[model samples]
Target: MDNQRRGFPKRCQCGEPVVLKTSTTAKNPGRLFHGCPFGRDGNWYHTFKWTDTSMVEEIEDLIEKVENIDGAAMTLQKGVNACESQIDTLAMETRVHLGVVEKEVEEMKMQLRSLKNIVGFVMVMVLFFMCMY
Candidate 1:
């Protein structure tokens, strides 16, 4: 089984519970971070470095960072929102294309049935002519 506890839970650095908006990775390993809405201007929490011992201190530092990094956090938020919008658009388009393909498949089935009926009729006519002969 995979070690599911890869990072710390979504909490702030100040040992105070902050509302977590989202979680994203950073350039460093074991340094995943979260965005807290409790900052002075609702900025991103600092990148929390995870260690086995000082998890509390790490969470506090992250809360302070979130209070500090306003510009960087706003950029990240915009990027996330844009990507989500694009994904929603793509999902809708895919659903529409799937519907069209399903309709075509149904039409093809109907055509196949019609062709089978015609072939059956021709076979019966040939048998009748043979009997007359």
Candidate 2:
């Protein structure tokens, strides 16, 4: 990976550009090394020791760290999305509750008006009885 990122080395003795390939065997999983592109034709130029194991480990470690950071960022984004959805749901609930409260208030106002009319009629009846007496 590093070699690909930095660019391939100069041509081998076979006059073909070396290719960087990762080892996939259980013994050397994820190990990066270089090889001659024409090695299958018996040119056989290889450099397994060009990069030290420690260097390969360092690069692998950096790659793992980057992957972890990306995973964490995705998790945080999902949490933010969930919070926003909850906020929207609560806002809707609050609007519905406000509507119900407003209706109750209007009903109370109508009841109060009816009570006031009843009280005024009682007062007038009392005044008429007093005049008669």
lDDT of 1 at 38: 52
Write the residue-wise lDDT of candidate 2 on 1-133 in tens digits.
5644333355566666777767677987887766666554244454333345536666777898899999999999999999999999999999999999999999999999999999999999999999999
Identify the runs in model 2 with alpha carbons over 4 angstroms from their true place. Answer: 1-55
Question: What TM-scores do the predictions have?
Answer: 0.46, 0.55
Per-residue accuracy of model 1 over 17-130 as CA lDDT, tens digit each: 534332333554454344334554234453232344245655766777787787688988999999999999999999999999999999999999999999999999999999
Best lDDT among the predictions, by candidate number? 2
Rate residue 20 of model 1 by lDDT.
30
Clashing pairs in 2: none
TM-score of 2: 0.55
